[model samples]
Target: MYASYKNLKIEVKFQGQHVAKSPYILKGPVYHENCDCPLEDSAAWLREMNCPETITQIQRDLAHFPTVDPEKIAAEIPKRFGQRQSLCHYTLKDNKVYIKTHGEHVGFRIFMDAILLSLTRKVKMPDVEFFVNLGDWPLEKKKSSSHIHPIFSWCGSTDSKDIVMPTYDLTDSVLETMGRVSLDMMSVQANTGPPWESKNSTAVWRGRDSRKERLELVKLSRKHPELIDAAFTNFFFFKHDESLYGPLVKHISFFDFFKHKYQINVDGTVAAYRLPYLLVGDSVVLKQDSIYYEHFYNELQPWKHYIPVKSNLSDLLEKLQWAKDHDEEAKKIAKTGQEFARNNLMGDDIFCYYFKLFQEYASLQVSEPQIREGMKRVEPQTEDDLFPCTCHRKKVTRADLLTHVRTKDEL
Candidate 1:
């Protein structure tokens, strides 16, 4: 017999407490807003503006072009264009750590892993410490403030004094990585036993304290249309599941909730189930089959079925060839991804991104000796200096530092 939406279930447990229960129903017709369409259009425009032949001809004619003062050109560009001010701020002493993760659903794990790798491989700031959300950390382990820092839950307020800089939101990469990781972790639990049993799986709402906060989210959604889609999908899925239990009593870590709510079987098999339809459109339809069956399946073979079947290797090869034919466009896309990674994930970016706010905490003026010592301790390289601001005992503007170096050279 074909499985019905009634067959799907999820259980919610927050801080060892069960608050509510609901059914998991796969609603028809999921829709995704075409966010990339505009980006694609923009790329096409750039291609038209700077065709390869045009670029080549321009390069050849460069010798005959009139020279202009770069400084004059720089001065001409407005610091703030129209009403859009720079969202980012830079200062000499601000010490902020911005975190980003990758992937749509399952990409958060990849992002975290990447961040961890960056932390270990990249340079470490002397006075600055690293942190991930408390809810994201392993539940079995206790957090040590002395060793590493921790961010409070999204719903909780943190002391501005304790934090040198404001936390930038998680990147799409991080969210996607988390989604994949959650699926993988849940899949393992489902195969192993009773706790991991599919019958017991559930989703719950735990973040906000009252309807007012929830309403505020709705208000915010108006200004940021992306939130309308993303947040609505999340809540709708939580509400639709019947076998699923709780919008748990309080907020809980995904790890702990998974561990306590389900049991692992002795044979290494996990119980699997689908979540409810959260979004109102057809996009969810495309994801429906695998979202439940394939995502939770333990065996690799069943999972393969969830993946769309390719008619033949040759057909796939043809698509790859077509991509290669548009090498310049492909290169641009690759460069964009690399730049995204560098701007959002690199160390210096993280620092400068937060430093603007962090500088406000300083009461005493920072001196050159202190800056030199801090620089010596961190020894930041180009890769490590991805952030906008540099960390010294005192913050120094990048422009000022460059001018000083140039002055020394002239001497």
Candidate 2:
């Protein structure tokens, strides 16, 4: 059933617009100032601090697999954030999240759960919506207001003051990890010889001219064509920088990435979403340093898993030459990166990371009305009593702490 709150009035309805709309959402909570809803502005801060979109995810997952409880933990709202008994809790069948923003965003919204794997409506939005930021080519100009919640984009700085959910891509779900990236890695590795053996010695990079650093990388390719093979995937996106990106190629499939010896991983938008997949391959990834990083980046080492390039790529050609000259060392780095992804960065890691992060946030939830008390209740719609099949509670317990501290194995 649709999540309709008595308090939430569905302000507007768009007909056939999801087809026209772009799918990518941004890094932080987005607020729609144009939507003059009554209850939205007052509860805006809580929306920023928590991932209410997770409720949609939980509902969808429970609809499919009824066995998974996903370990719930409760917290009182922190004094720094609020003092009210306004509990910012995440539970199955019982989540009380005010949908911060709603639109035809694909890549950027909350994981809501693995439900994106099943449902067409990406979000069954709460009436109380937040901002809807368009993180496109040119950054949106910051509005002149004190309550500024700038989107933390993939290409955005990680140090921004805006409150955001634990930074992650929706692909972190098991569906993409096993069905998409992992399968692609396996197929590519199986079809091709090792990076040191049959791969081309030239440094290869394929992506849109989304960022200046990427355009510059393509420019470097012209100077040393023998060593670098760089091209734009869509030069059409280039209006002002057409001359610089004119020579770039149209597109490269994900499977074709393994054909090269050195795969140049650069930042796009905010972080390189492909880097995680690239690291799983045999190719030596020459990654450029950037302020933006994904959820799992801290677990990786620059020179250990993949070679780090300078921010400006001043040594791009030199780095390519060194890899060509020292093929074995480059292969070693490639092998290490593959192993790191295989052993550490799995679908389980994504679940656990979000699990822990949510647990911490739950602990600070305001504890007044408690679970269902004082809160408005719906008939609790679903095909079955599937949501949060186990372990949702009105009070904190020791079991919550144990789950929080333990790793996947411990859990």
Candidate 3:
């Protein structure tokens, strides 16, 4: 899995076509003089992009999950737990996915299916049974007996033991709407509005009142309308005091977010799933720092990829002013962040992360996974199988367009 090369040519091919600069020669850490400079020159990028860090991250995330002698952690997976949590058990065996514990969360299942389906097409997946937490927060409580049990979730915290996986919203567009929503991974990237300079000068945000900081963000926007334009599209937590939070604003298109030069990413229940979309867009992301994080968050740098803001929003006003004063620097950060996402967060990278995550998890188990009684088998939904995605401009069939359009051979 680790490589030490001397004069190696790294050619990247996508969909039967050679990527623009194919065969990037690699001689140890540095490539040939006229190589893919920034990407190839940086040892971290090469190591991370190639999947070692991803594997290591998976190991670290699951470190607290207890391992038994001979390790048979797969069979030891508990059928019942004392604490009530939204979780579903799954087993990937014989190139098919089987569900042990049923979950009604379609969004989460859609994302998991995409990962398993993508992997099944490319490689024979080893039999592994794991639990997926459907809740917003990680199931592993601090200093609880849950540490002995492995649980996978969209987000994780330093104090928790849940293995962080990619958030479901990435591919949840395939749900009830029949892929009509722009929230899906492909459309989110493709429909990011105009360039940075062309966008509005103000920073914009719109979300439900899930977190108190979000409500405060809207209040801050009212006082400083010029620098910030934040509002709650829906109010739930503070419903009794809705009058103080202003009228509930109608939901806007995700593409409309890029109209502003800055995008505010405040976590709702856990780590906001919109961070990835914000990073992919042309505008700079003013991300709120929090304990919760997605799998790729560790790779992001503050002020380099995004302008980090205090979790409490106490210094948000100051951060906004600094961004306004340092327009060009802010623009560069936005560009850097966008480039990072465009390159590293491609469909292939996501699939690679999932493959390695489960692969490593499978390796740790000594028991041969089996399909539990009453478990239902889930099938992979290929491009042809997906419903036609209705776009704003036109109704487009998933088959007619590229939706995470990578082949197993490519992976």
Candidate 4:
């Protein structure tokens, strides 16, 4: 049998307090939020703070009040939101709110949950309606079967064969709601700034192989080509200051004339072969055994940078062959290699996107009536604010105390 359409409006109540007010009926008394805290903390915080004693009492009193079971709520949020969409909510405690659909494509579930939470907390009796655009096969079928019914904006074209509709793009009203919720969440999370925000550029590059060894080798080649070549070849030659036949030119077949004419060979080996040198300024310099391509190329003149040097031919062929044989391995290593710096750190962009979405969602306008109703239903309790708690205390505040104690004790 199809689920009854009692105009499903979920009212999220905290503790026993009615936090949200709307005509739409809510499913349960529990709510869920995405947070940085571990499962234990998340569970404990919600059980203790979000569902305070007072709010729990009110939840019991209401016949249609929604319940917030942590595990069940967590399963309802979406993993990602649209570019214009945000994930923020005005939850009772400092926790994240995540909502998604049930049974079918729950991609937007967490976002929807956040929207609901925000509406209750920020907006006052908002005439909001939830909607899903049926443009995909599964979704369209689900909608057709009455598995997922439209709660808002019933006007849609039936001729369109798409499973999801173009109108699925987050509307301005939704975005506005998200913006308000995001601000509230941000206020609770606090601005510690980015993990790499306080670090200097040099510090950021300190341990990076690209910055240290590769860059140093390039600079060394530019400054003293002959010295570098001599070191690599275990032979000393007269340092020449001409740009025409760089240390590298001796190895290339195109520059064979110059090599033979100058007798620029060490023992039986060609000078370029004996010593792998990249051209720097007007001459060629010794090459270092660094693993980055950019650093190796940057040492050469811009016009000649792409030109193949005899010294690197063997290495290039080896790398190319290896890449062909083990493409996945090469990709894995490349990704791993990128993790040494803040700029190329893994998941940086994704986290930034999440942060931005959080900000936008926090700024949404939750209905004031809902929040007031929730507040009115729940009684206030004298819980410990714990300004002196170790986890919540500030070092600066302690320093002030130390100064006062030291001076007062001395007096």
**lDDT string, candidate 2, 1-411, tens digits:** 122122332232257344334444453222221111222231342353343334332232123222211222112122222232111222322233322222334334344433222211212222211122224221223443333222222223434332223234433334343443444334544544444688878888888867788888888988889988888867544668877567546676666767888899888767777776688878899988887655456557887898889988998888888888888899999999989877655544443334433433333333322333332232222322221111121244687455544533443
276-384: candidate 3 lDDT, tens digit per residue: 8889887889999999998889889999999999999889888888998999999999989988887766665776677677777877776777787767888654233
Model 1: runs farther than 4 Å from truth? 1-78, 81-86, 89-195, 209-249, 256-411
Clashes of each: 75, 28, 1, 71
TM-score, candidate 2, is 0.56
Minimum summed lDDT over a 10-residue window in model 1 is located at: 277-286
The candidate with the higher TM-score, 3 or 4, is 3
Which 10 consecutive positions of candidate 2 have the poorest summed lDDT? 384-393
Q: For each candidate, what is the lDDT?
A: 0.25, 0.50, 0.71, 0.25
Better of 1 and 2 by lDDT: 2
Best by lDDT: 3
Task: Flag regions of model 4 displaced more than 4 Å.
Answer: 1-100, 105-352, 361-390, 393-411
lDDT of 1 by residue, 1-411 (tens): 111122334556677765575334434221111111111232343343332222221222122223322222222212322122111111122221233221223232333333333332222222222222322211112233322212211111111101212122232222233343343322322332232223222222223212233333334334444212112223333354312322334334433333222111110011111211111100111111121121112222211212121322122223333433554443343233323333333333333322221122222223211222112122222311111222222357788588656656766
RMSD of each: 25.0, 17.6, 11.1, 26.2
Q: What clash pairs does model 3 have?
A: 11-23
Per-candidate TM equals: 0.19, 0.56, 0.75, 0.18
